[model samples]
Target: MTEQRLAGKVAIVTGASRGIGRAIAERFGAEGARVVVNYIQGGEGAAAAGTAIEAAGGEALAVQADVSQSAEVRRLVRAALDRFGRVDILVNNAGVMVAKGVLETTEGDWDRTIDVNLKGAYLCSKEVAPVMIRQGAGRIINVSSNSGLYHPSAMRFTEYVVSKAGLNGLTKAMALAFGPQITVNAICPGWIRTDMVEEIDPETQQRILDETALRRWGTPGDIAAAALFLASADADFITGELLIVAGGRGMH
Candidate 1:
């Protein structure tokens, strides 16, 4: 029998009801990890994620918590510890985006975007860090975006770009603070075929495809695989890095 890479591990994935977060939760479970599928909404989808994990012979628990709130994030960590004894991985996948030009965006939209995309990661990481430090090991994988970096697409998304850019900074700061025991990293994915990205206009989508070296949209599974690698022992020495899983987008 082939041994699972994450056997006996515990992972907490926020905003895991759908999209990349859901994919990560399912993939982690299949690798033999006990998963905590966290969702701020989409309760049914979260439940389904847990169910699928269990169906795959892995342990799972679906918990509803908002990562942007400290109390809720603390609750999430507590629940995971209560159920599984220790946390092995934390994928801060909870994020939001408001597609508007800089001048067209509102303050409320900006706040919401930053709260979810950047603050959410901060709160979850803060809560989990103590547990991980006590255990002497852990992984924090931030689901960031290349739009947060030096990409042409960044021009149109002010709030989202700002939030994710902050997230990337947080990734590095957290990595510096949490090491050499805990590894914190970010995965910057390009246009993935999530419901969110599918909403893009056809013209823009085609333009993205043209710029992408792969000439196609990425899958949630692609991000999940990167998460798996970061969460595994193979990445023990790696931290404070931004991995561009964007099918080579922004390369040109």
Candidate 2:
């Protein structure tokens, strides 16, 4: 059997009901981490995530919380502590995308995007930082996006891009604040083949593939693998870095 890299660790993965977040939670579970699967909606999906984790030979607990709200974030962390006694890793994967151009974005669209994408990460991290600091070790992985960086598609989702950009900044700041004990990082994915992305028109999809250096859509597992690396001891010396899991998008 392959080594269980995260044996005995407890990890909390926010927005883990589906897509990239679910993939990361399951991957961590397979690697031997007790997972706290968090989701704001879709109870069935979150329950499935927990079941998958247990089936993969790790324990799992499902929690529902809106990470954008400080009280709920606190409740989420408290549940983890009450159940697992300690939290060794936090994957801030909860985020919302607003598909509007800068000029077309409404105030509500901007607020919701920032609240969920940027502020959600902040609230979760804030709740976990102290717990990690007291333990003298922990890992925080933020699920950001290439749009947050220099991707051409960034301009298409104005609020989403801005929120993610803010998240990138928070990742760096948290890395510094968390210090030598806790390693903070971000994974910036591009065009992952989620259900949403798969719904894009074929012509546009092909254009995206053609522009990617790998000529393929990145899978959720691709991002999950990166998250696993960041959460495990393999990244003990790594911090404040944004690992891009795109199919080499924007490289052209």
Candidate 3:
């Protein structure tokens, strides 16, 4: 039998009920990590993910928490600690997007996007870092986006782009502050084929494929693989870096 890479590790994956977060949680569980599957509203999806993890030879705890709220974030981490004893990995994958241009975006839209995408990461890290620091080692992986970078595509969702840009900055700052014991990093995924992306028109999707060097849409599993690497010992020496798993999108 092949050896498991993350045996005995405990991972908390926020927004893990579906999409990229679910893929990452399942991947980590298959590698033998006890997973805390967090969801905002999809309890059924979270339960299914937990069941899938257990069937794959790892334990799982499905917890619902809105990462944007400090109280809920606290409850999420506390639940993980109470269930698993220690948290070795934190995947701050909970995020939201506001599909509006700058002029069309309201104050509420901006706040919701920034609070969940940027501040939620900050809050989760804040709550978990002490536990990790006390344990002597940990990994914090933020699921950012390539749209955070300077690109024409970012203009479509102005608030979301700003939130992701803030997240990238937070990734670097947290890495510097939590060094020597905990490693912090971010994954900047380009055009992954999630339900959200699948909703786009086929013509637009083909245009994206044409621009991508691989000429294909990246999958949630692709991002999951990157998260696994960042959470494993193989990434111990790597920190404060953005791993772009976008199938060479925007390389032209």
Candidate 4:
């Protein structure tokens, strides 16, 4: 068998019940990292992910916590430390997207989007920062979206776009804040074939494919591979950067 790049490390992945988060958790586990999969509501999904991790000859635990809540974020971090002894990698992958135009977007919608997508990233990172700082080395990866850059007026989702854009800024700020010890970066995915994207209309899907150089939708595995690289020592010098995994669609 090949050597694991993340052997002996522990990683905490938020919103890992399904989709990209789930893929990241499994990938980290495969790389020999003891994984803590954090899910808000989907207990069964999280459990299944943990099971799969164990099946792959890795250690995993499923924990429940809403990232938007400060207390919950603290609890999640503590749970990881309690189970794994330390947190060497943190993947802030919990988020919600609401598709609506600016005028149609309500105050509650805006707040909810920001709470889960942007604020949740902040809370999780804050709770884990001290732990990483004490260790003198760590990795924090934020899952962002390409919408943060293009701002396509044709597509709605104003609140979602705003939250992702803010997350990009947060990624850079945190990277600079904890530099030379802990590396913070963001992965901006363009069109991944997650359940969320499957809900898009056929016309929209075709349009998206047409815009991409690859002419195909991306998979969760693609994003997982990028996350793995960012979490590994291979990317030790990388910080405060946004790696776009958009199948060349978002290229100007």
lDDT of each: 0.92, 0.90, 0.92, 0.92
Cα error, candidate 4, residue 229 (Å): 0.6
lDDT of 3 by residue, 209-244 (tens): 887889888989999999999998889899999888
Query: Which RMSD does model 4 reach against the true structure?
Result: 1.1
lDDT tens per residue, model 2, 24-123: 9999999999999999986899999999998877899999999989999999999999999999999999887765678898999998889999999999
User: Per-residue alpha-carbon lDDT of model 4 for 1-252, expressed as tens digits?
Assistant: 999999999999999999999999999999999999999999999999999999999999999999999999998999899998999999999988776678998999999999999999999999999999999899999999988876473359888888889999999999999887899999999889877666678888888889899988889999999999999989999999999999998774
Model 1 per-residue lDDT tens digits across residues 122-183: 99999999999999999999999999887886568898998988999999999999998899
TM-score between model 4 and native: 0.98
Residue 176, model 4: lDDT of: 93
Please give each candidate's TM-score.
0.98, 0.97, 0.97, 0.98
Predicted structure 3: clash tally: 0
TM-score of 2: 0.97
**Pairs in steric clash, model 1:** none
RMSD to true structure for each model, in Å: 1.0, 1.3, 1.2, 1.1
